[model samples]
Target: MSAVRLISNHTLKLQPQRSSSQLFRRHASSSVAEGSFTARRGLYASLLLLSTGALAAYYFDSRAAIHRYVLTPVIRHILDAENGHKLAVRVLASGFAPRDTQSDDERLKVQLWEDELSNPIGLAAGFDKHGEAVDGLFNLGFSWVEIGSVTPKPQPGNARPRMFHLMDDTAVINRYGFPSDGHATVLARLRARFPIFYQEGSEPHASLRSNALLAVNLGKNKTSPVESADDFVSGIRAFGSYADVLVVNISSPNTPGLRALQSHALLEDLLGRVTHALDEIATSESNKSRRPKLVLKIAPDLDEAQVDDIAKAILQKSVDGVIVSNTTVRRPSTLTDANKAEAGGLSGPPLKPYSLATLRMLRARLPAAVPIIGCGGISSGADALEYAKAGATAVQIYTSFGYDGVGTCRRIKDELAEALSREGATWMETVQRASAELSLKPEDRSAHTSIAQLTKEAEELMRLVDELGERVGGADPSKDNSATESTGVLPVVSNGTERSDFVLFSMANARQWVILDRSDNAASPCIFATLAYEAIDQGAQVASSNSKGRTISGTLMYRRGQLLERIPRHAEASEKLYLDYKIKPTGDKDKKLIWAIA
Candidate 1:
């Protein structure tokens, strides 16, 4: 009985010890699982934080590599060219667009008109067709943000699929045809940007940013009269108060009869009326001190005659600047993209040669006083530099910007800065030097010579004039005669008629003669005789005398052996000259210039 009880007690004790060990194992397993959960939570939190930081950095930095290598490519691949452009504008307009955080290098700094730009880089007009993303684009480091081809009335523009991407060629073809929200809508958007307590200062820019400018590109409505400047005039009057620059966009290939306005007579009328409207605006109380500059946007397809006509109109109308050129209608053989056959204006790498050639030709024709803004297929810093060396005051980009995304402006500026640093030159300095060296000299400006070769016929005529003057008992051709040295009288016979009432006057500045008829009831009262003198290299100076010995002075430009007088409005005899002769007006009220073919 003693042995049996000892065995049973041992069994019970072993059972209790086994149960306690089981509880301990369960507790150990629970602790390990809890520890693993805590470790996983920590790892997940770390990953989230790291990813958030990385995304923030990438989102803020416009120069981030991901934008160029990944995001831009993905966007280009996913969306059609038109949709992609819309989405970009939407993002920028949403104020979520990445900003260029870096400051522009000093070498890239350029002066445009009265304002100083942080850089010479500019965004072209067609990008922000409705002024929807002006500030957003400015955030991307563009010093000049041009918006709108805004017409007087709203229009839907061309059909869908109007924008095409030439991926292989790095080009874009678009025929949006000035799709806009009209002048009223765009003006409201611009005006809404003003501060609540805004006050007009002595010098306020349209951009509202000290280093930037806002240019409004004005386009006529498709249904409007293509030959009229009324639409452009209305645009100026509406937006002139708010815009820093007003661009007359008459070069879009999509618009019918739009290019016809570029013809000599039509351009003269268009520029004349627009300039007159600007003058009226400038003299108004609202725009007393500030006058928005006028810029002409031309196409790249203009021939030599068309270009010369354009230049003449620009100079005559006193336009502030020109944007050389818009998208090209000509298809280059180098374009290998499937969309190359698209019937729209082509813009991209293929446009570079046409645009650059046009820019060079225009620069040579325009004087230094008028600045030329280079546009069309300017994608790289080298392209911008090439424009600068070719006398472009500034450069604009569109297709490259579309293909490259928000980083384009920064990339181009960086490239240009690097190039300028290597050359030890600034953008403005290069442009100024090129302009001075390449621009046409005063004496060399011949209407015919600009297009065709100059004939030796002018030299022969000049010699004939000298021989005729000597035979008429005039003073020696070699002597520089002052008006005071002569009797103010010259007897000359023309067509077997002797006129004793002809008086001689020497123009002090131009060294040319002015022959005024003192006879009463003469059919042609004023005769300007171009006397060939060895010292007369400058343009002719015109003068006329009244009864009180008062003198009227003006400039006479030599155009292919013919004299075109630029009559001074301040001259006392200007009204009489216009009324008596019924001079052909240039359509501007401020212009008193008359054309005399002889």
Candidate 2:
């Protein structure tokens, strides 16, 4: 009985040990499985973080190849032309747009008016018609951001499908018809861009960037009379204080009868009123110190006569600058895209020839003082350089910006810098040289007599001035030490001393004259006559002649209380003169200075 009981106890103990061994093995297996799962989770988390960082880096880099190759293509494929534009503006306004991380090359710097731009590349007006994405566009490295074809009142523009993309041709056509958010809405957006501690005097640029500019493109409302200048005048009043330049848009083919304003008579009236309004704004207390420059935007479809007439109006009204062209209504044979049949202005590679032709024609007629901003189908640095060679002070792009995505500005700038370096010239230098070569000279006149005839007339006028000086100041005509025999013009002096009233002299060509005020308290020391001596001769009555056949009966008309000093005198004529002076008629109050024959 004792042996049987001991056997049962041993069997029970053995069973319990077996159970313990199995339990130990199960725990070890479970631990191993948990460790492997944890390692996989860690690997996945690390991969996720790495991928996120890489994406962020790519998105921020303006020159990232992925933008041009992947993102832009995807967006374009997903959205239609108008939708894509809207999305772009929204993205930019939302501050998610890619930025240009690189600093502009020294070769890209351009001096325009009173400001120096970081680069010559600029975004044209149509891209941000409502002024919603000024800062974002600037982020892409555009030195000039022109917002709006903003009308006096809000407009819905044409119907849907108004915008078309010709992918094959690399062009776009739109009939937006000056669709705008109106002057007030756009003005609010511009004002909101100002910083918390904004000071107008400290930052003079409307763009709010030191090396950039903001321009407002003014367009007329379709509901209003096409012949009236009221809308444009109102635009100047509304945005004049907020913009560096005010573009008068009279060229959009989308707007009915808008092109009519470019006619000779209509243009004259329009420019006259516009300049008057600008002057009023300039003289106002709010903008007395600084006023926005006035620029005229014209169409690409103008004929030679139309271009000539436009140039005449620009010179006659003293328009500050000119934008060479807007979009064209014509279609090129090279356009194979199905959307080519759409009726609207065409822009892109095809429009280059027309824009270039118009630019060359107008550039030849206008003086260099009037800068031309070329806008057309410029897709690369070579394209921009072509415009620069044709006398464009700066160039603006639209269709290319639409097709090429955010990296467009950076890419073009890089290409332009390389091209300029290869040529060993800066943009400004190139433009200056081109302009000097292409533009008309002061001596060119189909109606006026030859320079030799004018020179003879000037010499005769100088002899008359010598006799007049002798009669007035009682100084011998020949004994005056300041008289220049080579120039054949006598300097106005009192008893061989510089006179305080004014000094009058004729240029060797007799086409120009100079007036100097030597008074101790004179505000300006020099004043140049703008009208040619031939005009003076034709208008003035020859009252009589002195014993020496010298006549001093002509009248000199000049703007009153206006002074222009430090004119660089002609190098060949007078060594004493340090500067040349230019005088333009302000169309304001005039005072005549008359010298009578004795």
Candidate 3:
């Protein structure tokens, strides 16, 4: 009886339980009349039908809106809506011209050809001069790719049909100038599809993200030449944060007076400002643990003074890197791009030597610590080897990538690896070493070494002076010049009545020296003859010290007769020697000795 009673009560409570949210709400108004009692029921059914239709309409409308805005743009880009395919076609055509098509056997033979044949190749900035098909170039296999001379503003570049494909020469003549998609748009596209290296066992991305190494080249759209430095700095700041490396492209011949920025004052000012900006970004990024490299892409035609000045600036500002040799306005005596006669920088076969020369030249100007990424005129492995051997830290190929297909990078990597193994060096070490051996042609090497050379030479000269002193009793004590002014000094003498000699030694590298005055102490055996530089007390005790607080052990090399007689009757009387030192103030903390002046 209790169980039956509980069941009845639970059923009663379960009547029509109300929902937390809107559900079974009462109608706001009654429906219009239909015909009779049956008509009223029919009207209620009609209302339900209308409500369902209204809700379905709203859903379709919302979906349509989403499709129109969000989905369309992304799809359009993926589909190459902005004529993006042309970029691929152009890059393919420009990079691997002449051989619009190549046989498999010929492709296989390229790597064995040599460094001068391929490695570091060229892609003149304005080639795509418009931000078209960078993706296509990557697919063809370039170790690295450079795209755009993107400006702060959009530009159409020179004129229509400014790009000329020279079939015979296997090169393209582009006076397209620097067409750009502006800073914001291109950068946004690049960000969304940011490239990643598709290596073995690498983390995956959303879809077909690029595996190629990226370098985004920014250029001045149309220079207000007076504000050149400001333009470059702005370019650097705009794209400087996200790129793997930022290139300050003051070397483009297309922009008026752009090359003049290569002048010492202008170049230094520009590079100094740009690198400082890169560093600030680097520091902020380091906290996040990522930073872009800064590199300057210079022209091939710069004179030695210009190149030296650029190197001097790099050393002064401590720039991240440099890229040698861009396309040349100077035409080579060749026949590939007969239209090459058109007024534009000549690239392809003729540009190879010039580009390589620039690499060798820039290598000489920059310090070993500073890396040079050699580009331009490389169409084969031989070309790559030349750039590698010429002293580039890494090489980027553009034009040849277009011709070669995606296999280019793989082939070049294999060839470069072989070259490195044959030479018994790692890739980087190979460049540095091979560069030392390259007999730079006049065009490739700079003749000037002002600031850097002067500083190093002066230091070496000072070391020689010190070396000469030990051999011939020190530089005439009269020559107290500004030579030691820069670094700290320990004064040995100040009092007018007597002068004390002092030597403060610093060991930064290897050096050699031999003490003179052998006749002064014939009985004393050679204590540190093989020392080569720093004298060692082979078998002597530190008995006493002279001035300047440096204690050294040596038998009497000079002394009075009485002092010598104290040693042995047979010993020379004029022998005298003393470990050098000076009395120190009790307050100083780092002193090693406490010899008192007696």
Candidate 4:
């Protein structure tokens, strides 16, 4: 009877069936978990879409709007000038700086140091003293990006307020005395950058990103000796394999004695050492036979003599190139900005006249092979094209870039391309035309060539021959001398048997000519002989026969136009050296016939 009652109680409890509610509660909790998981995934997807949209907006759009309307104004107003410059660098280095995506116009393509640049526009140095933003600057569409006035050692440079903005004049004046992170740090950056794109035994300039060049502007430390090339040499050793071009920064007026390097003697020594260092670097197996192009940056403040001296030295040293100007100390009276009076190197519009004049002078002095990079007072496409017309191979901008913001290079390129289209010329065509027309030509050498100059040369040659006759008797002209035969192509014998004293101005050319002057006084019969003058390192050789009998030979020379070194040639002492003969009378009677020896 007890067992039956227990069974009945169990059955009654089972009949209530509370397990159904428990099952429902479990299902509800499971549903809630699944809904939570789905909502979280949806939130993640939404966030991802928003982030991608922001990035696309930042990167795919034109940088000009942000640079002009937002970034530039904010930076300029928020921070002081130097600090603002620092901020700009940091922003560029951060890789978020707005970049121009427009392809460079085909007309803007040009050459710089054997490399085809996408555009002729480049960014000048001083904006990135430490080489902190080379890639960043290049990303903005500059065909060439020059970095640093880097020193052998770190320096504080000039005091605060060293940079002054002449907003009214659209110019900048900075006495930044080559403040730098020094060779070690800068070199590390370069080394770090090289392996990213280049492999072992490859050329940094020709192999990695050939369309754009990375040039480092080398400067001396404040304490280093001005005459000593130790700093530049060391810089070459440190960065030669890494940089496309190494710029010798001797033109900065802020440095105590830097400008003095432009003088003949000092410049020769400096260039010699720098070139030697470069040669060594090129030959070094560790450097992969990479020959870094060497360029000298000069000042716009140079005088005529100084400019001539520099051009001659550059030719003599076989320098790769020259930057027409760094900056000017001369303040134009037209500058209305109060900061114009500040003590610093002046740049921008005021510097245009000086820089352009200097460039034209240099173009007139140097051969077309040695290119001049124009920098200064370039704000517009017209300005850059003006430089091209004035014989500049490429144009660089500093003050204009600073004043105009990130769009400077693009704007200049666009404008330049438009100008080029209007003129029906390519950038190379324009540069070549200007170079051919404006650059110094062989035919029209120096201005000092005249008949009197030839007479003076004749006298010097005679004197030298007299001296040489004393040492190594004059060379026999009839002998089978291959060198002589090769040099004298159009041999012209003397017309008269009088055997009058004649100076043979011979070049390695076959052209033949004999110039005779119809003298005003019939008895005198003065002859004016003008010859082509070829400037050479070794002065002209002098050789002559003594009035009695014996002949002498040696080199006798003089400076041409206070610039080129004259090298006189001594023809065979036995035979005369004239190709043809002619005489003409001048309009002015009794005017002494001056034979200008070029």
List the candidates ranked by lDDT, beginning with the highest: 2, 1, 4, 3
Index of the highest-TM-score prediction: 1
Q: lDDT, candidate 2, residue 205? A: 78
Task: Flag the better candidate by TM-score, 1 or 4.
Answer: 1
Please report, in order, the local distance difference test score of every candidate based on alpha carbons: 0.72, 0.73, 0.48, 0.70
Tens digits of per-residue lDDT for model 1, 1-598 = 1122235546522222346677799999999999999999999999999888767756677877777888888988999888888888998998887888898898887888898899999999988988888889999999999998999999999988899988889998898888889988998888877786554324478788999888999999999988999999999899888889999999999998899999977886687678767767777776677789999999999888788778767775678899999999999888888989989899988898888888888887877778999998898999999998888999999889888888899999999999999999998899889989977544422332221111232222233233323222233557653331221222344444544433333323233333433322111212321111100223423333233222223344433322233222211122233333322221221111222111
Mark the regions of model 1 whose C-alpha exceeds 4 Å error after superposition.
Answer: 1-32, 199-203, 444-594
Better of 3 and 4 by lDDT: 4
Compared with the true structure, model 3 gives a TM-score of: 0.52
What shift in Å separates residue 247 of candidate 2 from its native position after superposition?
Answer: 0.6
**Candidate 2 residue lDDT tens string, 1-598:** 1122235546522222346677799999999999999999999999999888767755677777777888778899999888989998999999877898889999888888877898989988899999999999999999999998999999999888799989999999899888899999999898888877664433577787889989999999999898899999999888887888999999999999999999976786676667667767776766666678899999999999899778866765667889978999998888999999999999999999999999999998877777899999899999999999999989999898888788899999999999999999998889999999997655423432344543454454454344455432334556643543324333443344533344444433222244422222211211222222222324433343345332324343432212222322111111111112111221211121223222
Across 194-222, the per-residue lDDT of candidate 3 in tens digits comes to: 44542211222111333334567878767
Prediction 4 global C-alpha lDDT: 0.70
What does candidate 4's lDDT look like per residue over 145-188, in tens digits?
88899998999999988998887898888998888999999878
Ranking by TM-score: 1, 2, 4, 3
**lDDT over C-alpha atoms for residue 375 of model 4:** 94
- Model 4 per-residue lDDT at 461: 34
Q: Tell me which residue pairs clash in candidate 2.
A: 567-579, 567-580, 568-579, 568-580, 569-579
Error of 1 at 417 (Å): 0.6
lDDT for model 2 comes to: 0.73
